[model samples]
Target: MKFLLVFTLVSFIISFLSDRNKTFAGTKKGLKMFLGLLPTILNVLILVSVFLYLVPKETLIKILGHNSGWLGITIAAILGSISLIPMFITYPLAAILLKSGVSYRVLSVFITTLLMVGIITLPLETKYFGIRASILRNILSFIGALIIGLVIGIFL
Candidate 1:
């Protein structure tokens, strides 16, 4: 907020001092764009906080572990992928899980698959790329996320 205040002050001064009207107009446009996006940015942060509060840290950690074998991993990934919860929510949730003994690898899979394979966004994706393309991309990405998680698990 302080940084934004400083930026606003700087912009105001620049706009006021500038002789060229074009420069002032350009600055105003930039400021308007920033202001327009601020609400979405703040909303995302608030949702993250809320999700972190609502979900139990232990359960998140359990989901992070793949001790349940491939079936468990598949189930967890499928659920996570189906979840339309925003990334802002997922990251802090992952942080809590990580702090509570969850494996980073599983969390990575959850997050990667969560973002990459979106059942909720399927309508939009399908509209853009037909049903087959969307399904193929999602399947390929899901498998890729699984493999990456396993490889990271071995090292971590």
Candidate 2:
């Protein structure tokens, strides 16, 4: 976390020093991006709280707490691929998943799928990258995620 803080500080200072001509615009863009993410962040927090309340911790931990094996990995990947979650909020969801005892291998595959292929973004991706190319990319990503999950399981 310290690295993140230092990185942010350095970026701010660098942007401030070099972009003196359009500092206001830069700050405005930064603020707008932050503001744009607020709604998603709030929603994630609410969801996390609700999930923790509704689901028993021990049951969750037992199901996901590292012993569920291949079933958990498959489920995580499928759900992750179908879910239309933004990158910014995935980490917190990840934390919750981890706490619930989900294996790191499953988490890895799930996260990989979440970023590389989104069901909600399929149309956009197809439009931007062509249908065949998008399909190929998603297929390859799915396979790669599965392989990586197994690798993580083996090593971990």
| Top candidate, metric TM-score | 2
- Clashing pairs counted in every model: 0, 3
- Could you tell me the lDDT of residue 118 within candidate 2? 73
Worst 10 residues of 2 by lDDT: 59-68
Q: Which candidate is the best by lDDT?
A: 2
- Expressed as tens digits, the lDDT of each residue in 43-117 for candidate 1 is 876876686578676665454454645654666588778988755456766776566666766677777788778
lDDT of 2 by residue, 8-121 (tens): 889888888888758768878889998999998888889888988898887776656577776777788898788888777888788777766667877887888787767778
Q: lDDT of all the models against the reference?
A: 0.74, 0.81
The reply for model 1, stretches above 4 Å from the true place, is: 1-66
Give residue 92's lDDT in candidate 2 (0 to 100).
Answer: 78
Q: Which portions of model 2 show Cα errors greater than 4 Å?
A: 127-132, 153-156
